[model samples]
Target: MSLFKKKKDELNYLIFEVTRKCNLDCQFCYNHWKRDNDPKAEPVKEGYTFALKTLKTVFKQANPKHVTFTGGEPLLAERVNELILFCRMKGATVSVITNGNTGSTTEFSQLIKVGVQLFELPLHSYDQAVHDRMTGVLGSWKKSKDRMVGLMKFGAYVVPVIVITKQNFSQVGETLELLNNLGFQRVMLNRYNLGGAVLASPEKVLPSKEELNEAFKQANEIAEKRRLQLSSNVCTPHCVVDPNRYRNILFSNCSTEIRQRPLTLTVGGDLRFCNHSPDVMGNIFRETIQTILEKSSEKYSVVARPDFCAGCMRYEKCRGGCRAAAQQTGGSFNDVDPLVNTIKENEETEIA
Candidate 1:
């Protein structure tokens, strides 16, 4: 089977968690991004060599429609240029999600020279003090914003991801206004997933459903007015826009179109199925791309949940989703069932 998938397994989004180490600790971060427990050892530039080999395998396996570079902070990872090169090596449009604190604008520019098409960063709060307070670091707000400017200066497409929580929800308008003024092409508004220890206080992290719907409506309105894009993810909602033009949205609960994705390729080249699971799908270095898919597809059959899709009537679409967050956060399959069912009921009522 040569093990390299031709197109059947082609994915719409390939999210790679290149590393677990992060510089600053955001209070509402869903994963324990702050606590990188790699009893294995500390991070070093040496990691990139391993990264290059693994990426070659990923490019062949997924045949991604779009590939996203992500991490505790991807810019902190070694050989980002090499990784971008590999992703571009594929036909996939390349993008990255980052915290924007790294001090390598030149390196970022170098990646831009290639086919890295887009950059999404944290645009948490309008005021530096407020942003810094949420992130628990001084000057992070200033540094991150400056880095966003750096990305735009390089002529790369940019989108800022702001997680909505108690502290920052009230200031969403201010944040969007600033991004619009700065001429960013888009902003993705994220709802905090009360999963990791970072968001132990559900009270602070999970905004009320009414609040989220209202905010999404207003943000969409503002984004439309400014001609900017806003998006959310992780089982929140869905809104398909003009084939080319985009809008602010939640990335959560997307159809199976985006589920069943491995969150990370380990240092050893194994595909860890989920962020919290960290279990491997065999080492890509040893197996052919086709074999990798066959194995992962089988794994999904055993673990993926199709019946209780949280926000999808099309359970067959995304399967059970990446259940790592539910595992770690103490939610169950039932928790998501209501989400999908409730939305469906409301949708049906509206139609009726």
Candidate 2:
């Protein structure tokens, strides 16, 4: 299935960071790295008017098909509903990535009523203790689980996002079992990148290739047995698993093309080329969207690929893996993805 298709200049996706305040403290939280310098930084409490105007400008400029609200926790933002409604009014489908424990059922229903077509919920483990530990909240497991079910019952398309890490990699099957039992039809497995709060202790969270492959094997089996749809943000080499077994999980990463189309707007209205990187292209509220896009396009006109990937078979599709991953692992955005090295080692082992 073609997940995303857009014209050369059309912006079809917008990921907005609505706020920087979160109720739960996930140890592997990306926001931690984003806001570590000032944990107490205030949320965008009173930016509703400006936010709405800026969003209208974006809608008119890009005519996006989808607008996703994400953040330290988008539900915590005061005007999240308004933003969703505004995007919907502009002919864009809306979605929110939330921890799911912050708001009441009524509030979530209200969001659905306004225009939230999808809700992305994070579920790290089936074991309550492990989940709670990962989230750093004693009761987060129960709250998040209940919230997921509540949203599903409320008639929202709830997609479980499981971030795979050393702490929860071994529980892939159990986690899928819980998701299957919870009546979820699909789950997205996100590979833990060496960014955010984990950067300080990458060794603790980064799973080895063997562990990741094992997790994928178990997850694929469980998903098939349960007849659930499984997708992954982690771009693995084609030879890692049976192509047919992972066909559904496999995805193309056209970072160079995507970098120019999709726009990430921070809560403060800063236009960022990458969510993981703090580099700001421009401020949408201060400048025109066209100008920001032009500046970003010029700046990222050429994404240099690694020398080793010059003639690799997957070069066209994988585009040298994720640039964010490259930067996090090799300390340079243009460096070869560390996964390439791991995949090469795995290939040698298979031949020997």
Candidate 3:
């Protein structure tokens, strides 16, 4: 039997964390758990040799159709162009999520020349002070905004990302307006999960269910009016938005489906289920990619949904909400997601 029951073509998305270093210190960064103990933990600015070896394994095993280069910041990786070129040579289209800090116009041009299809840039809020405060950097908002504009001029497809948190939830309208003014065709708004840096400060960063629902409602309204494509992470429930209007924006919450695609290679050569997961299934340097994935499938098999979830109307699509969020907050992957519970409570209150 195949390690992946699905055909090879089904597993065609690979998310490679090219490096572990980042320029800005965002307060709610999901990768914060990686920085827990090491005082010397700075971004691994350059690692061509390790990266090349890892990419070789990925190409040999997965031969992905889409490769998303993420990191502390993929642009900060040494010889990143070479890595992007390697993916292109293997017939993979590439995209990158960066803090929008590094890279000259020439550097970005070179990357685009190598077939980078999209650039996902972060934009926290319209208010510079709020953004800067969340990022823990004095001038990140300006730098990121400037970079977004510069990338747009370069004709790179850029999507501005807003990681919704308590600090920025209320400003969702203004943020989308700013993105629209900047001429962005699409924007991504992700809810802050209780992982990484947020684990240390969930109370400070994570927004309440009411806050998140309201923000999405407002943002969706603005996005529709401006004809901007809005995408989101799996943290929100379908009930939060108009299902008919935002059907495409709602994401699947099934770990099984997610695990079947998008193999993640960390900077240290560890294969992860996702960036938010701390579990290292196997090391690509030591084991074959196929072998590593097989191990991951066995060890990280999908969690069984609770009985209550089976009867919910949105059960088929939502699949019991985000597994990582449940694990982080409720201490088990199978625990009912707090967001779902919150929505249920709201429904009960209304009925009462």
Q: Please write out the lDDT profile of model 2 over residues 24-59, one tens digit for every residue.
A: 877777542443453423455335666676676676
- What C-alpha RMSD separates each model from the true structure? 6.5, 5.6, 4.4
What is the alpha-carbon RMSD of candidate 1 to the true structure?
6.5
lDDT of each: 0.63, 0.72, 0.75
Query: Of the candidates shown, which would achieve the greatest lDDT relative to the real structure?
Result: 3
Ranking by TM-score: 3, 2, 1
Residue 283 of model 1: what lDDT? 67
Off by over 4 Å in 1: 1-12, 32-46, 59-65, 90-92, 237-252, 257-263, 273-282, 285-323, 331-352
- Model 1, residue 123: distance off in Å is 0.7
Identify the superior model by TM-score, candidate 2 or candidate 3.
3
Roughly what TM-score does model 3 have, to 2 decimal places?
Answer: 0.86
Error of 1 at 304 (Å): 8.0
Candidate 1 per-residue lDDT over residues 1-352, each given as its tens digit: 7576366455556666676667887787655333345233345323687777677667655566776777777877877777777778777788887888874877888878886888878878898888888887899988888888878887888778787776777777778899888877677787665455453456655555555565566677677777766666554423211112224443444333224453455545655545544335566678854566566665444335544544555444344443545444445432332223335555788899
